[model samples]
Target: MDLGFGREKRLLTPQQFKAVFDSATHKVSSKHVLLLARDNQLEHPRLGLVIGKKSVKLAVERNRIKRQIRESFRHNQSILTGVDCVIVARRGIADLSNIELRQQFDKMWKRLARQRLAADQANSTGQTNA
Candidate 1:
């Protein structure tokens, strides 16, 4: 599978980000990060980053955090299909080192993948029972 971080794998427009924000059906969070996700009706998952200055304070720090998030997503995209996710950065995230950031995102991605699997199973079973 092509696990590249291309434009098609990113939530480029405000409208796409807004859709995930407004109707996020799954949420995974930590002290300094929150991940919100919903079904996108697509073949691959798209990622949106919301690392505001208020959270990270400096542009460099925010960019670093975004890079870590995107890298983690790229490595885990195979298991994250058919979802649109928005990762919101909170205060204190900038304090984490690169290794910590990577670990945190890896944990969050696993949780989100599990949620997606459960949702898919539920949908399939619900359809059959209907």
Candidate 2:
């Protein structure tokens, strides 16, 4: 992935998302998905993508999605701070190009930022925090 155009703050490890998924609150929808990730607090925001065989039949297709996601994250990971994210693909995602993938990723990132800000505001208010 040629992500040198932007710097990514990544915590690249399986255990990171695993721990968050084990105990985190989450929100999901067709346009975007997210987890209220706080497991890897001391490190920078990180990302993981699950492109299963069921989503993309061929290994090459699956790898392409993974690569696109990695590049997307590398290019935009800074927008997500103090959180861990894992983007699991739906079955229809294989045909998207790198640009399309990035656009989808940007949408997801925007949704995530909205959620994070809401969560922070809720926390500050001691209200119903996700």
Candidate 3:
């Protein structure tokens, strides 16, 4: 499994981030973060993080949050195949410990996966019935 989060696994451009922001197909949120996901055409999933300074004042905190988010995404990337995911940090996120953030991401990833699977099944059945 290619678990490395290389450049190809990142949403690198403005357009790529905008695409997910404009028409996110799946959403999973918690008190400290919100994740928006849209299906993409690639064979792998891509990730974008929006940990603004307004949300987390210190640059060090922001970087820490980004690291945690990326690590979580790397472990759970398989569940997010062919999707573009943007995770926006909310206020108070900087207060959470690494373990707490990890747990939150794990739960959110599972929820998003269940949602996507349900939607895919619904779409497939709808097309067959049409």
Candidate 4:
């Protein structure tokens, strides 16, 4: 498994997850609901995804969706700098093909850009080396 953003050091822990969830700004895009998050407000890019069982009950289905999301970020992490993004999968996701998934992600990112937090290379990098 590709784990995530490459390095394991930067992945979100339960503590970090809580921090962002408690204070991050949020928006709903046509594709998915984007959780625009920050820690104490950290100033680097970070990302997390939540594909619920309700949306894709089978592990295989959920994992496939997750792989799609992670790969999207791994390649486009630079586009979103300072803000942390969390994509919580909804039921509709179960029906999407890769093309449709990308379309949805694009929509979500475009919407997220409006309220984005700037990313700084220093302090924290934009991704977790998962």
Per TM-score, the best of the predicted structures is 3
Residue ranges of candidate 3 with Cα displaced over 4 Å: none
Arrange candidates by lDDT, descending.
3, 1, 2, 4
Question: What TM-score does structure 1 among the candidates reach?
Answer: 0.95
Estimate, for each residue in 1-130, the C-alpha lDDT of model 2 and write its tens digit: 3344223444356786676667664454453223344435633566666667877799997887777777776676566656767676776787777788778877766777777788777788886543
Q: Flag regions of model 4 displaced more than 4 Å.
A: 1-4, 8-11, 31-34, 39-44, 117-130
TM-score of every prediction relative to native: 0.95, 0.75, 0.98, 0.71
- TM-score: which is higher, 1 or 4? 1
- Taking all chains together, the TM-score of candidate 2 against the true structure is 0.75
Clash number for candidate 4: 7
- C-alpha lDDT values of all predictions: 0.93, 0.64, 0.95, 0.63
Off by over 4 Å in 2: 1-14, 31-39, 127-130
Model 3 root-mean-square deviation: 0.6
Candidate 3, lDDT over the whole model: 0.95
Q: Rank the candidate models, highest TM-score first.
A: 3, 1, 2, 4
How far out, in Å, is residue 127 in model 1? 3.0
For lDDT, candidate 1 versus 4, the one ahead is 1
For candidate 3, write residues 1-130 as lDDT tens digits: 8999999999999999999999999999988899999999999999999999899999999999899989999999989899999999999999999999988998899999999999999999999999
Model 4, 54-85: lDDT tens digits are 77888987888887777666656555656666
